[model samples]
Target: MSSLRQALSGAGAVLLAVHPTLAQTAETSAPTNASAPPPLLWFLISMLVLVLLVFWLILVALLAWMRPQLRQIYDLPTVHDTWSGRVLGLLVGDARLVKGEVRDELLDHDYDGIHEFDNDLPPWWKYGFVLTAIFAGCYLTYYHVLQNGQLQGAEYAAEMQQAALMVSTTSDDPNQLTTYTALTAPAELSSGKSLFATNCAPCHGANAEGKVGPNLTDEFWLHGGEVNHVYKTIKFGVNGKGMVAWKGKLSGKQILQVSSYILSLQGTKPANAKPPQGEKEAPAKTLAAR
Candidate 1:
């Protein structure tokens, strides 16, 4: 004991001597003053954990309370060792017992000679109601009073804003090639052909030689023949010319693919070609400027 005391005293003296040196070194070095997040964040985390723990405890207690009843059910001759019977037992406990309990629940007062039973609500229903109340209270506190989360309207607006940003970024990409400059792969052309067959064939004819609409398989175009011009014409459409705007029906990529397909069809002679409806071809820049 004396040796241990002497050793502790020596250690304490060494610590005291080293303390000043350590403090001086620390002061000379960079001061690490990093702080943790706000206490409210930790408080919310703790509350969530507490709520989960409480729910767990409640579930365990409910299961423990129901054990005896379950055992009784399992012991019944009809339900013994049968999965279906066990399920039925859990869903709707012994009808005979329920009927007997209902008799005891009879209320003395009668209205219009009709006796009312003061039976308690089913356990499953009551528990569900209690859980709903708890959920509502928590939702109100977190989303409204404390302002910890966004409401539905705010969340939707935020998502819409994010979507618009994504669209703007994609549209503004300097190196992003349009279908006219980029498309050529066999698969991409095939996709465009399929889209054209499905959407554009009805009015322009299956081979795009003209039916109710102008011939697509020719150099002459009612709208300008430039890729961007064709793209805009398809997107906006001629208001009184019976061509409905396709932009709302098709995505931008789909529109580009279909436009590229139309470009591919130019200069081919058709059996029954429609007469040219617009002015003779002009330069791409001039057409776009219009």
Candidate 2:
């Protein structure tokens, strides 16, 4: 223990001697004064705040000045002109307090045989009926003489012409080169399947087994069986046939993909096909075969 104490004393003296050198270094190197933050930072923040405050003040003043103008534009009534129900509940009453637009449909309920047609609809309410009648007159004038095609088959013919113009699939030889585009990718097939689920599944089953529309998987086709022919049948429906035109319901690309999928169903027959109604058979495409 005496030897350890002697060693500690020697270490303490060494440390004590080093402490003066450290103190001198600290005295020489320690910052006497720190630099103030850049005035530009404070200046930018102060300017931003001042600009915001000025903008706020300007906005408040603009709103205050425009208040009367806004009120005039909206036709807000002055205090004197504003409605305050009838004096002494006589000529002017709570019944009159009802808005000018608010009309009551008073049923024929009379107490003690005293019938009263007390207050009819306000002028504003009556004007709505008048406006409706006036519009009806204009409607008749515009539709009957000016554009009578809406009814009586003229409009129907015009509409058909418009549709025929839209389908631009023309041919050099009607016998060959059917204009329908074929869908080959899995992406196209998936999209067609989704579309069939949404549109045709309710009619035709999801797998094209017969439901409301005919089975597409069967070799037998009501209209025709080829991809292009199927596209045609889909685009412009067979006349007097349960199958309606799907041109508007499905886009051209969607129709092509669906037709391609249906063609892929060729040579495979489902359990039920409606006895092949149409005489036409699709031109064979070996590529479309499974």
Candidate 3:
């Protein structure tokens, strides 16, 4: 009966350890749904509850079977002396020193001058150790085997993806500058040249001859050569292409200035110019406005 009780207790401990870990993993892996709980998660939870119910029923039956033997023990306390003592008893069960003294029979044989007592492990400490081991196993499997846990690289990637999504979503606001009317102001043009030299030179080339990006010096345009079209393309990038929306990184006014500088570069042939990409634009209506 004692062996059976020990077996049942160990099984119960294992069940308790696995139950929460399974639930947490299921919750994280399952797809989110507003209408109902994810099917996989619901199934796992239901199975866990059923297993727990079976364990509870077995425990109740075992207690009932031991009722006759329990009645023979006349030394049982009517009530714990204090709430703290009751709580301690609930955690550690009946494993404790009798009258605060060790029995001579409980001493073990001396080994190489060292001796030990055969004291039973406290239930709380034993269960805590078991839970720690279970957690360590689950953590190792999650990160190493399944690769589901968010390690440093994965976390950084997720953050970068979220940031890109935020940029794409916010760049479409109507309030943002989406039109470029060509700035003729000397100060604005100077600023625009500086901005272009720093940001666009690497791809478009320093002389706007084009290296990786389309040639700004030529009349040809990939998306349309109009001033407003160029401004819109710069602000909200060309999708599926290398051009990233600069709205998140650059101010609207700065983009306008950069567009103005590019406009200034048109019709002026530069050294080592790349051949035109798209159809030629009908020369943008004057460099002053519109």
| lDDT on C-alpha atoms for all candidate structures | 0.73, 0.66, 0.76
Model 2 global lDDT (CA atoms, 0 to 1): 0.66
Q: How close is candidate 1 to the true structure, as a TM-score?
A: 0.36
Ten-residue stretch with the least lDDT total in model 1: 171-180
lDDT of 3 at 154: 89
Q: Pick by TM-score: which candidate is best?
A: 3
Off by over 4 Å in 2: 1-178, 280-283, 287-290
Q: Order the candidates by lDDT, highest first — what do you get?
A: 3, 1, 2
* Highest-lDDT candidate: 3
lDDT of 1 at 270: 69
lDDT for 84 in candidate 2 is: 33
In model 2, the clashing pairs are 86-92, 203-212
For residue 87, give model 1's deviation from the true position in Å.
99
**Per-model TM-score on C-alpha atoms:** 0.36, 0.36, 0.40
